[model samples]
Target: MNILVTGATGFVGRRVCARLQKSQSYNLSSAVRQSGSNPPGSEVVIHEVDGQTSWQCALKNQQVVIHTAARAHIMNDEVADPLAEYRRVNVDGTLNLARQAAEAGVRRLIYISSVKVNGEQTPAGCPFTAEDAAAPADPYGVSKLESEMQLRQLAKDTGMEVVIIRPSLVYGPGAKGNFATMVRLVAKGLPLPLGSIRNRRSLLALDNLVDLIVTCISHPNAANQTFLAADGEDLSTTELLRGVANAMGIPSRLIPVPAGLLQFGATLLGQKALARRLLGSLQVDIEHTRKCLNWTPPLTVEQGLRHCFEIRQD
Candidate 1:
């Protein structure tokens, strides 16, 4: 199999490349952003991905393209017209690459989207599913949703298979953003006020997500399907903190702060979204993914956390 993986230098991309390389089965080609950010096997160094970017050179002889490159979602962006900035890369760039890949006879293109496409929070036990109507709440989510629509249409128009995988808060080795911050705080034995947060949030282990992506590559049932990927186990903020403490073999240092008080403070600070994220439910139902791809997360939450923290020490 001739597989081309975009975002080769990214957290998930690097792991995907490494996992694929270890197998020594597929002819893996990694598309990196810069010159020196190589990932083992064959490399295609594309400086930037945008509307005007050309991918014909890279798409040649590539059978399956795992499109993982995109402008990551962030709370604060220092760019003017954040929406345009998002569209430039996420929307325009992805479509351009897809179009070229289709023309270049790429058989499949798997898009790594976000669970944000299904909306921010789900009602208590009602997890988000692929059947749910897309309700993107942010510029990044909107851009992703737009890209998904385009990809699906391109799949219909051209005979290229497009697999969409939306993963929840991904965590593991080399993880970043909120999850990384939480691990660091727990490791430092700092008092975290998330004990009172009874919210259940879904998380996707990096290995689990990579496993799903790899499974989707050749799975006939995965063609033209949008799958929500997660570890199948949901955890509350308090439970998560305690789990991290247990995983680290340290005492759980958490304060019982009221959710209402936290929300109030966040409101005053104009961070209501951040507050909801900390004290709300955002779960994803991976039943469809399991049924469709015959896949299950290969690692438990504890195992994934251990791999992460252990790697952090090195």
Candidate 2:
């Protein structure tokens, strides 16, 4: 199979390329920006991603395209028009790539979306499923949802297969953002006030997500389907922190603080949104993916955490 993966140097994209290169069945290529370098042993094509950007050179002879590039969610966006900026990349850029891929005779296009397309949080004991109506709460989520819709329409018009995988918080070796911050705090034995946060959030390991992406590449049943990817295990804030601490071979020093107080404090500090992510529930149901794809996460949560810790040590 001739596969072309965008965002080939990104956290998830790098891992995807590594996995695909190891498989003897694939002849891998990377579609990167002019500024980005190609992964070793893979063909590279440079093209800008924008309204006027062209992907003809990259899409040639490519059977599958795994799009992992995007204008990621910004925590404190200083831009005057955040939505427009996101749309320029997430929606417009994505659709442009899909249209060209379809015209180039590509067989499948796997889009890596986010669970935020469902909503910010799930009510207690309820997990977001693939069938749930999209209720994206942020601009990034909205753009992703719009791109998914556009891709489906294009698929219908071109007879090209489209497979969408919406994954929850993805973490593993070299993870940054909130997960990395938590790892640092835990390694330092800092006292965290999230002991009272009893919310359950689903997390996807990088390996698990990559595994599912690889599965979607040629799976006959995956065409025109949207699948939610997760580790099939949910953890509370307290449990997650403690698990990280355990993996680091340190004691977790968590101080019990009421979730309400935490929210209030975060609001005063202009971090209410961050507080919601830390204390809220965001669970996903991957039963459809498991049953439909006959797939299972190869790594347990503990094993994933251990991999992360070992990477940190190196």
Candidate 3:
């Protein structure tokens, strides 16, 4: 099979390329903005162009096109017109790539979407499922949802298979984002007052997410389906932090601050938005994915945490 991977130079994309390389017997084409940081061991045909034009040529004769590229979340984009930019890249560019892939007779287009597309936080006792109404809270999430809609339309029009994988809070070695920041904060022996929250949120390990993506690539059940993926278990902020501490071989110093007080303080400091998401319940019910794909995440929360700590130790 000939596969094309966009965002092949990114954290998850690099890992996926590496896995594809090791598995062998397939031709790999990687699209990147730059040429120097290609994934090791994969003899990737690197094409330098933006997503709109890049895929026009890079997707030729490809059996599967994994669209992992996107305008990733940025905390500093607080006041910017996030919707416009996000739509341009995440929605428009995604459609362009999908169109090219369909035109090139690509069979499957696996899109790596964010779980945020199913609303920022699922209601208490009402875990999110693939059939849930997609109410994206942020511009980034909205963009992803819009792109998924476009992919569905393209699939209907061209008869190309579209598979969507929504992963929650993915973290592991070399992961850079909010999760990485949390790991660093815990590693520094900082006292965090997150123990009071009793919310459960699902997470994705790099290894588990990679495995799931590979499964989705060829699994007969994954065709024309959207799946939410996680480690199959939920962990509270306290549990996650404690696990991180354990992984780092350090004692957790979690304090039990009142949630109201924390919110009040954050409001006073103009960071309430940040505090709520950090200490909120973002659970997802991935039962459909497991049942349909007949897949289970091999890594537990503890194991994933340990792997992150092990790799981050330098």
Among the numbered candidates, top lDDT falls to: 1
Clashes of each: 0, 0, 0
State the C-alpha lDDT per candidate: 0.91, 0.90, 0.84
lDDT for model 2, please.
Answer: 0.90
Candidate closest to the true structure, highest TM-score? 1
Q: Write the per-residue lDDT of candidate 2 for residues 1-314, one digit (tens) a residue.
A: 99999988888998999999999999988767754485744656656676677888788899999999888877778999999998999999999999999999999999999998999999868999999999999999999999999999999999999999999999998888889888888888878898878999999999999999999999999999999999999999999998888888899999999999999999999997788889889999999999999999998888888887787679
Q: List the residue pairs that clash in candidate 3.
A: none
Residue range 205-261, candidate 1, lDDT tens digits? 899999999999899999999999999999998988898888788999989999899
The lDDT of model 1 is 0.91
lDDT tens per residue, model 3, 1-314 = 88888888888888888888777766787777665764644334544333455555677678998888888877678646889888888898889888888988999999999998998886555788999989988899999999999899999999999999999989988887788788789878889988787777889999999899998888898999999989988988888888888988999988999888888889999996777676678888999999999999989989988987787765
Q: How far is each candidate from the true structure, as Cα RMSD in Å?
A: 1.2, 1.4, 1.9
Model 2 error, position 175 (Å): 1.5
